[model samples]
Target: MSVIQILIINAVLVSIAMVVLWLVSLRLKDASIVDIFWGLGFVLIAWMTMAVATQDLRSILLVAMTTIWGVRLAAYLAWRNHGKGEDSRYAAMRDHRGGSFWWVSLVTVFGLQGAVMWLISLPIQVGSCETVPMSLPNYAGLIVWAIGFLFESVGDFQLARFKSKAENNGKVMDRGLWRYTRHPNYFGNSLIWWGIFWVSASSSTLWLAISPILMTFLLLKVSGVALLEKSLANRSGEYRDYICRTSAFFPWPPARRHGSKLV
Candidate 1:
C-alpha cells in the first residue's frame, strides 16, 4: 500500500476508535480516560502500518519500539490515574460546559487528541514502508531511543515512589531525574519521537521531520511543560525554587543556590 493510503487508513481507524472512546467516556462521565488511551493509540497505528506495509527489519524495529513505549505509557497512566476521578482539567471543562459537555468533549478532547496522535505517528507509518537496509542513522536512533526510554521510565518510577510517601505531600520533587530537569518524562518523550524520526530519516522521508518537531513543540510549548508549569507556578515556593535551579525541558546540571551545593 502507498504511504498516503496507509496514513488515511490509520486516520480513519483512529477516528473511529476515538469516537467509540468518546461514547464510553460519556457513559462513565469521565473524559480523563482519553489520557490513558493516548499512548495506545500510537501503538495501534504502528502495528496497523506494519501489518499493511512492508515487513522488513526496519518496520519490525519501529513496531517494537513503539509497542514498548506505548504499552508502558498506557500502563503507567492507568495505574497512576486509577480511582482518581476525572482529572481536574477535564472536570473544569465539564463544569464550564455544563450539560453540553458530553458532545463538546467529543470534539475538544477525543477528536483533537486523535488527530494529534495520527500526526505524531507519521514516522512509524512512513518508516514501515521502507524496505531499504538499515543505515548509520537507524542504529544511532536506536541508541537515542534507549536513552530516552531509560529517562522516561526511571523518572516516572522515582516520581511515583516520591508521591507514594505521605511525608512528601506538598513537597517539590528535586531529587533523582527531576534534579536535572523539571520535566524528565516530557523531555524523554520528545527525544523518543525525534529518535523515531531519525530512524526513518531518508531523502524522501525528510519532510516527515515535522512529526518529531511537532511532538517537541507540544512538549515544550503546548500541553506538556507550559500547561503543567502554569498549574505548579502557584503551588509552592519550593516548586519555584526547583524551577529556578532545574532546566525546564532539557536535562542539565542544576544551578546552585546560596548556601546549597549542587548534588
Candidate 2:
C-alpha cells in the first residue's frame, strides 16, 4: 500500500479506537484511562501500518520496538494507577467543565490525543512502507532505542519502588536514576522517539523528523517535564533543590553543595 493510504487507514483506526475508549471512559467515569491507552495507541498504529505495508526486516524491527515500549508503558501505568481514581488533571477539568466534561473529554482528551498519536506515528507508517533492508543506521537506532528503554523502564521501576515505601512519602525522589535527572522517564521517552526517527530516516522519510521533534517537545515542554514539575513545584523545598541540581531532561552527575553534600 502507498504511504498516504497507510496513514489514512491508521488515522481512521485511531479515531475509532479513541471513540471507543471515550465511551468506555464515560462508563467508568474516569478519563484517566486515556493515559493507559496512550502507549497502546502507538502500538496499534505501528502494527497496523506494518500489516498494510511491506513486511520487511525494518518494519518488523519498528513494530517490535514499539510493542516493547508501548506494552511496558501500558502495564506500568495500569499497575501504578490502579485504585488511584481519576488523575488530578482530569478531575480538575471535570470540575471546571461541570456536566459537559463527559463530551468535552471526548473531543479535548481522546480526540486530541488520537490526533497527536497519528501524527507521531508518521515515522512508523512511512518506514513500514519503505521496504528497505536493515542498515547500519538501523542498528545504531536500535542501540539508541535500547538505551532509552533501559532508562525509562528502570527509572519507572525505581520510582515505583520508592513510592511504595511509606518512609519515602512526601519526599523528593532524588535517588537512583532520579538523582542524575529529575525526569529520567521523560528523557528516555524523548530518546525513544528520536531513535525511532533515526531508524525511520531515509531520503524520502526525512521529512517525518517532525514526528520525533514533536514528541520531544511534548515530553519536555508540554505533558511530561513541564506539567509534572509544575505540580511538584510547591510540594516542597526539596523538589526545588532537586530541580536546581539535577538535569531536567538529560542524564548528568548530581550537583553538590558546599561541604560536599549532594544537592
Candidate 3:
C-alpha cells in the first residue's frame, strides 16, 4: 500500500480501538486505563508500520524508539493506577456532568486523546510512508530520539521516586531531574517526536511537516504538557513554588533568584 494509505489506515484502526476501549472504560468507570492503552497502542502501530518496511534503517530505528517509549509509559501508568480509583480528573468531570458523561467521554476525552495520538504519530507515519533510502540525517535523528528516550525514562524514575519517598509524599518534586524543569517528561516527549519528524523529513513532504510541529504544539500548548501541568498546579501548592525557580519545559539551571515570592 502507499504511504498515505498506510497512515490513514493506521489512524482509522487506532481510532476504532480507542473508541471500543473507551466504551469499555465507561462500563468499568476508569479512564486512567485508557492512558496505558494509548501508549501501548502506539507501539502496535509503529511495529505494524515497521513490518511493511523496505530495508530502511530509519524505519527500524523509529520503530525501536517508539516501542521503547510506549512500553515504558504503559508499564508505568498501569503500575501507578493499579489500585487507585478512577482518575480524579475523569471522575470530577463525570460527576459534574451527570448522565450525559458517556457522550462527553466519547467526544471530549477518548476521541480527543485518539486524535492527539494520531498527530503525535506523524513521525512514524512519515517514516513508514517515505520512499527514500535512509541517510546521515536519519542517523542523527536516531541519536536525538535516543537522548529523548533516556531523558524521559530517567525523569520519570526520579519523579516517581520523589513521590514515593516518605518526606516527599504529597509534595512537589523539585530535585534531581525535576529541579531542571517543571515538566521534564513533557520536554523529553516533545523531543522524541521532533527527532522522529527530523528523520521523516528526509522525505521532503509538506504535509508530513505537520508531524513535529504538531507534536511540539501539543506538548507546549495542548493536552500533553499544558493539561498535565495545569492539573498538577491545582493539586499542589508546592508546584507553584517549584515552577517559580525551575524552567517550564526545557531543562535548565534554576535562576537562583532568592527571596522572591514563589507564587
Candidate 4:
C-alpha cells in the first residue's frame, strides 16, 4: 500500500472509532469519555501503520513510542475521570445545545477530535512508512521524547497527589513541577509532539512539521492552559499571586510578585 493510502486508511479508522465512541457517550450520557479515547486513537493509527508498512527499525520505533505514550495517557485519563461525570467543557456545550446536543457533539466534538488526532499523527505516518536507519535527528528526537515523558508523567503524578490531599484544598499548587510552570504537563505534551516531528524530520516529510506546531498551539491556547485557567483563576488570591510570579507556560526561576504599597 502507498503511504497516502495508508494515511487515508488511518484517518478512516479513527473517524469510525470516534463515531462509535460518540454513540457510546450518548448512551452513557458522559462526553468526557472521548478524552480517554484520544490517546487510543493515535495508538490505533500507529498499529494500523505497523500492519501495513514493512517491518523495520523505523516502524518498530514509531510503534513503540506511540504505544507507550498513548497507552499510559489513556489509562491515566480513564482513571482520573472515574465517576467525575461529564467534563465541564462538554457539559456546558450540552447545556447550550440542549436537545440538539447529541448530533451536535457527533460533529463538533467527536469528528473534530478525530481529525485533529490524525493530523497530529503525521510524524508516525511518515516515520513508520519510510525505510531509514536511525540518524542523529532520530536519536535527538528520542532523547527529547524521553525528557517530555518525564515531565508529563511526573507533572501529572504530582498534581494528582496534591489534589488527593485534603489540607491542600482551596490552595494553589505551587509545589514540585507546578512551582516551575502553571502547565508542565501541557508543556511536556507539546514537546513530545515536536520530538516526534524531529524524529521523522526528512526532506520529504518536513512539511509534517505542522503536526507539532498544531499540538503546541492546542496545548497553549485551546485545551491546556487557557481552558484550565478560566476556572482556576477564580480560586484564591494566592493563585493570582502564583500567576504573577511564575511563568505562564515555560519553566524558569520564579520571581517574587510585588503588590502596590501605600498607593
Q: Would you list the C-alpha lDDT of every candidate in the order shown?
A: 0.91, 0.91, 0.79, 0.87
Clashing pairs in 3: none
Q: Provide the global lDDT of candidate 2 against the true structure.
A: 0.91
**Residue runs of model 1 more than 4 Å from their true location after superposition:** 259-263
Please list all clashing residue pairs in model 2, or write none if there are none. none
TM-score, candidate 2, is: 0.97
Model 1 local distance difference test score: 0.91
lDDT of 2 by residue, 1-263 (tens): 78779988999999999999999999999999999999999999998988888888889889999999999999999999999999999999999999899899999999999999999988898888776666788789888988999999999999999989999999988899998999999888888998898898777678988998999999988899899989898777889888888899899998879775655
Q: Which ten residues in a row have the lowest lDDT in candidate 2?
A: 129-138
Q: Judging by lDDT, tell me the better candidate of 1 and 4.
A: 1
Which is the better candidate, 2 or 3, if ranked by TM-score? 2
Candidate 3 — worst ten consecutive residues by lDDT sum? 254-263
Tell how far residue 243 is off in model 2, in angstroms: 1.0
Residue-wise C-alpha lDDT for candidate 3, range 141-256, written one tens digit per residue: 77777788877888989988877879876777788878888878888887787677777767465466677777778778976778887888898877776777799998989867
Better of 2 and 4 by TM-score: 2
